[model samples]
Target: MLKLMKLPTAWGLRNASPFNLKAEALLTMSGQAYESIEALPNKGPKGKLPALIDGEQVIGDSSLIQRHLEDKYEARFDDGLSEVELADAVAYRRMAEEWLYFINLWVRWIECPTITRDAFFSGIPWPLRGLVFGRLQKDVKRTLHGQGLGRHTREEIYGFGEEALAAIAARIGSGPFFFGDTPRSVDAALYPQLLNVAEAPYDTPLREAARKHAVLTDYVRRCDQTIFAAREDLPNVA
Candidate 1:
């Protein structure tokens, strides 16, 4: 049996981090028998969550986990996609992970800090919560700054997010999935992040921007019902 170490669920989603959801999506899509355990990033080899424990081997990062599944387990998430479609999928996945992710970080941690801080650090004792949360916020801001999106104004950042959502909506346009009717690896990469922005309990412009795209919200439901449905049966998911 395989074990997945991931962060706790939040906002009615499988995991707080979209990357964790991506890794689990890959596992479920691969039809592997696995159990999920709640864990912090430090437990992973690369100081990240969603580490797959296969016997003595610990696989870190979702992309590497996908490779492990493909090579070792013969799982093919994009079996039917054409080369062009595959390339498009890669581009969209990069947009979601790299570009839109920083926008989300700014909105959640900087714009709506109180709500996010409460949600993530509520378990910590009051005396140390401020200290711990301050450090976490600083680290996240530093990461966003390094990504360059944090350098932009809030309005500009939200504008970028709206543009990204509009682009995704234009591409999808009443689709059963990203590329086609089939759910591919890119769907695993994308669905969770979009869902987090659209459904998470925040009222920031980023969430508003995501809400503007009816196609995307519908797509999230479609993925939840089809691609991610199997995950609900997993033991101790939260």
Candidate 2:
């Protein structure tokens, strides 16, 4: 059995971090027997959650995890996709994980700091909570700055988010999944990020932007119902 190190579940999501959720979704959809162990980012070799432990080997990063599943376990997430279709799927997944991920960070940590602090940091006690959240927010800002999104105005950030959502909606269109009726690895990558943006408790312009796209919301709902249909016992943050 594989052991997946994950962050705590929160905001009605399998995991508050989209990457963590993505890894879990891939495992679930692949029909793999795995154990989700609640652990911190530092616990993993890469200092990130969603690390998959297969015997003595610990695979870090969601994409790497997918590769491991495919190479080692013969899991076929892109079973029927043509070369061009696979390329397209990869492009969309990169956009979501690289670009939109920063936009989400801005929304959660910068735009709605109170919500994030209260939900994730309140357990630290009063003064320490303030200190810890302050440090974490600073680190996030530095990361975003290095990524170039933090330098933009808040409106510009949210505008980028809206555009990303629109693109995702267009790609998904009327299909049940990114490619068609069959769920692919792209769906696993896309679903959790969409859920984080559309369903998280925080009310930011980014969330509102995600909501405006009916296609995106519907896609999220379907993924939530279908991909995670078997793991209904997963806990949620109250």
Candidate 3:
């Protein structure tokens, strides 16, 4: 059996960070079965999660993992998308990966403690919520500095996130997936970022706005049911 190293036990619906969710969803959609191992990069692999070990091959990072899976499974769409379509996909994926980071940072630093505490504690059934929260706070701070958003105020981050999301929504148009009919690479990539923002423990005004968006909310629900169901069943990480 192919084994996926990740924070979630299975590939689908795990409460993983966005990147992990994307990788798992892709795997699930491909009809591949993988065993998952909980990874704590901060404690073990230099602060990474969702690393995959398949036999003697060890891979880390979500983008690389997706590429690896695509190569091995050959399950990506082959219909020739126009250059414009391809470009739009790449652009959306980048925006999703980049802007969503700030959303997560905002949630961890500002919103998580308030809305997520009860949900997180009640879900975990473990006594390590404090430790998890502490680590998440530290990680978010580090990530913010790494992304050059450390100096920006929360208001700035929120504003930027709103703009980014609006841009994504505009690109989505009336397509069920990012690419209209069928899901493409970009759909797989961006969906997780949106999912993270919408489902995070924080229910801030920004998150609530995302939730209110019909298309975005529907997309998250579909991914949760189809791609991430396995992860959702696991004990909450924190």
Candidate 4:
């Protein structure tokens, strides 16, 4: 069994961090037994979550973890697809992870008018959580600005994000998963971010924009109802 260390679930999400959700989904879809361990924020290699431990080998990053699974455990992670389709999935996966991922961050750490920050900071002690949150918020904002997304207006950002969602929905078509009948490697990367934003508690512009595409909502529900259902080895957060 593989062990994945990541942040605990929060904000009405299973595994508040999308990378964590990606790891869990890959493991589940791969038919591999595994357990989840709650890891500290920005604690793993390159300061991220969902680091996988397989015996003596520790893998970092969601993409790298998926590759490790495919290369070492199951070469069929992207199975059932022609090379061109696999290439397309890889492109969408990158778009979801890099662009949509940051847009969701913008919503949470920048434009959100709700308790997302507080919920995230709840992991820390009472006195220091606020201070830590402020510091981290500044860092996140700086990162977003450097990523070139912070310059856009909220309206622009929401519109930009919705376009990406639309692309994913179209590519998924009427299929149960992105690549057709079965979940693809792209689904592992894309579903988490979509679920996190679309199912967010507040009715913000970003969430509203995401919800406009019926297929996007359905895709997320399908993924959640299928891969993200409760399991015995799931962990309890502090």
* TM-score of every model versus the real structure: 0.96, 0.95, 0.79, 0.91
Quantify all predictions' global Cα lDDT against the true fold.
0.87, 0.88, 0.67, 0.80
Q: Which stretches in model 3 have alpha-carbon errors above 4 Å?
A: 9-13, 42-46, 114-136, 226-238
For residues 1-238, could you state the per-residue lDDT of candidate 2 as single tens digits?
A: 8888888876666678999989988888777878878898899899887899999999999999999999999999888789999899989999999999889988889988999988887679989899989998999999999999999997888889999999999989998888888788999999889989999997888898889999999998898678878775553311
Q: On a 0 to 100 scale, what is the lDDT of residue 194 in model 1?
A: 94
Give the Cα-based TM-score of candidate 4 against the true structure.
0.91
Could you give the candidate ranking by lDDT, starting with the highest?
2, 1, 4, 3
**lDDT per residue as tens, model 1, 1-238:** 9999888877777676899989888988899879888898899999987899999999999999999999999999988778898889989999998888778878888888988878888999987998998898999899988889889987899899999989888888878798778788998989888988998888988888888888999998898678767766665544
Q: lDDT value for candidate 4?
A: 0.80
RMSD of 2: 2.1
Name the runs in model 4 displaced over 4 angstroms.
123-127, 228-238
How high is the lDDT of residue 147 in model 3? 79
Clashes of each: 0, 0, 11, 0
Please identify model 1 stretches exceeding 4 Å from their true place.
Answer: 232-234
Worst 10 residues of 2 by lDDT: 229-238
Give the clashing pairs for model 4. Answer: none
